[model samples]
Target: MEIDYSHIKVIGFDADDTLWVNETYFREAEEEVGKLLSHYETPNKIDQELYKMELKNLGTYGYGVKGFVLSMIELAVELSNGKVSNSIISDILNIGKRMLNKPIELLEGVEEVLKTLSKDYRLILATKGDLLDQERKLEKSGLIDYFHHIEVLSEKQEYNYSRLLKHLDIKPSEFLMVGNSLKSDILPLINIGSEAIHVPFHTTWQHEKVSENETNGVDYKTVYSLLEILKFFKNN
Candidate 1:
């Protein structure tokens, strides 16, 4: 099937792993947490149980470093049978704080791609996470001015995108989303009749992983890097 870009007037970009280094930090934090909880369980079991706890707490905590940190603390409590030490919990808190304070490291070609695309299309930042955390990264990124709109969504389902497009008065055919997650970025946009481009990151959160069969019939393009998207747009 052919994919079209001529009708795309508004282009949405996903933050976090799509634009900068994110999942890597989360992985590092998880490793530290595993070691901190090593007295209670093996590293493998810690990871597995942590993932399960994340799923359970997703509704209450939502996505972001804060949620992840809370999950780590919860897992520590559970694995230790309420015998978790205050120092270990404090260390976990420090991990989350460090993540929140980490510098925003943009991926290669990100600014160049944004610069080129902004000149041709109405660019928007449509990432999901804790609002303040996302805002902090965007501010630090120095790429905020390149976008005409900024939206930090709580979720990225088809309906969420649909509501967003409607709010912005953008037609599905006129919208395009670029991101690293197939589940949140590609599938939702395709299902809502919008175009999407997938730029996979080296590290992905387990929650965002999707089976090949799940994306079998999805209409989207997968590119190796953000720069490749520049070739897809037509010159006005």
Candidate 2:
């Protein structure tokens, strides 16, 4: 089925893995945390338990390196029966700090895609994470100038997208979302009657994984890279 994008006036981009290197760092941090907690449990067990902790605390900590770090600490204490050492706790804190301070490495053709598309369509950044951290990344990305509006959402759901569209005074048909997560970025927009394009990253967070049944018959385009998306709007 060939979809039409002629009506899309505002293009929304997801900031993290979709535009820059994000989930990769999370994976690395998880590996580091696994090693740090190996004394309490096997590496695989630590990894599994840490993911569970993150999910358990999602509502409390929301999403970001801060939340992730807190989850790691909680897991350390729990797995070690409150006997986890201060030095190990300190190591966990440093891991989060390192992740927070990591440089923004933009994905291939991110600038060219944004630069070209911004010339014709209104481009807005719609990403969910720690507002401060997201802002810091945008500022450092040097791509902030291309966006007309920036939204750091607490969550990405159908209602959230609907509210965003209403706030922007644009119909769902007039908006298009591009991102990496099928759960947060693609499914929500599709459910809200908006268009979305999936540009997957090499690594995905476990929380973002969606089953095939969830995507069955969903009418969204999956492009291999950001540069490939330019073709869809070539005639515009």
Candidate 3:
């Protein structure tokens, strides 16, 4: 689909995978937890247990570190045949705490791209995350100044996107959503009569990855890298 960048006055972006290495860190922590739990059960068994607990937590507490950490604790208890001790749970909680302490690494050349894009468009970060964790990440990333608005929602449903557009007083046709998640970022925007740009990431969170392409009748586009978006802006 052809895009006239000039018409897109407001551009919204998904934060976690788009701006920083979010899922990779989570995956690393999970691997560590798996090793710890492997003493009680095989690696495959540990993974299966964790996956089941994760799904159960998603239904109960939704997304974010709290849910993930709790799932780890619950899985440990189950895998250890109810022999899990407070020390094991404390160690698991410490691992989750250390995740927030992990340094935020901006994707390759992402800062430069955002700096250039902000000059020409109204950039607003529309991220779905745990409120406090998301806020701390933005503060640490040092990219907060580039956004005119930042939203941390429980989920990125079409309704939330519509409400955001309404709050910003921007037309659907005049807005654009850019991010890595096909489920959270791309589909919602396309369904709402807005333009969407899908930026694929290598290590997508299992919950956020789209299983199939559903942009057949939607006004959507994809680019290999975030820097490639600069091609749309003309020389001034």
* Candidate 2 lDDT tens digits, 159-197: 988998899898998899999999999999999899999
Candidate 2: pairs in clash: none
Candidate 1 residue runs with Cα over 4 Å from true position? 1-3, 234-236
- Residues 27-92 of candidate 3 have per-residue lDDT tens digits of 887888888887798877777778778888886777788788989998998888899878888989
Cα deviation at 131, candidate 2, in Å, is: 0.7
TM-score-better candidate, 2 vs 3: 2
In candidate 1, position 208 carries an lDDT of 97
- What is candidate 2's CA lDDT for residue 205? 88
Q: Which stretches in model 3 have alpha-carbon errors above 4 Å?
A: 213-218
The CA lDDT of each predicted structure is 0.93, 0.94, 0.84
Candidate 3: give the clashing pairs: none
Candidate 1 residue lDDT tens string, 49-126: 999999999999999999999999999999999999999999999999999999999998999999998887899999
Q: Tell how far residue 126 is off in model 3, in angstroms.
A: 0.6
Better of 2 and 3 by lDDT: 2
Q: Which pairs of residues collide in candidate 1? A: none
What is the alpha-carbon RMSD of candidate 1 to the true structure?
1.2
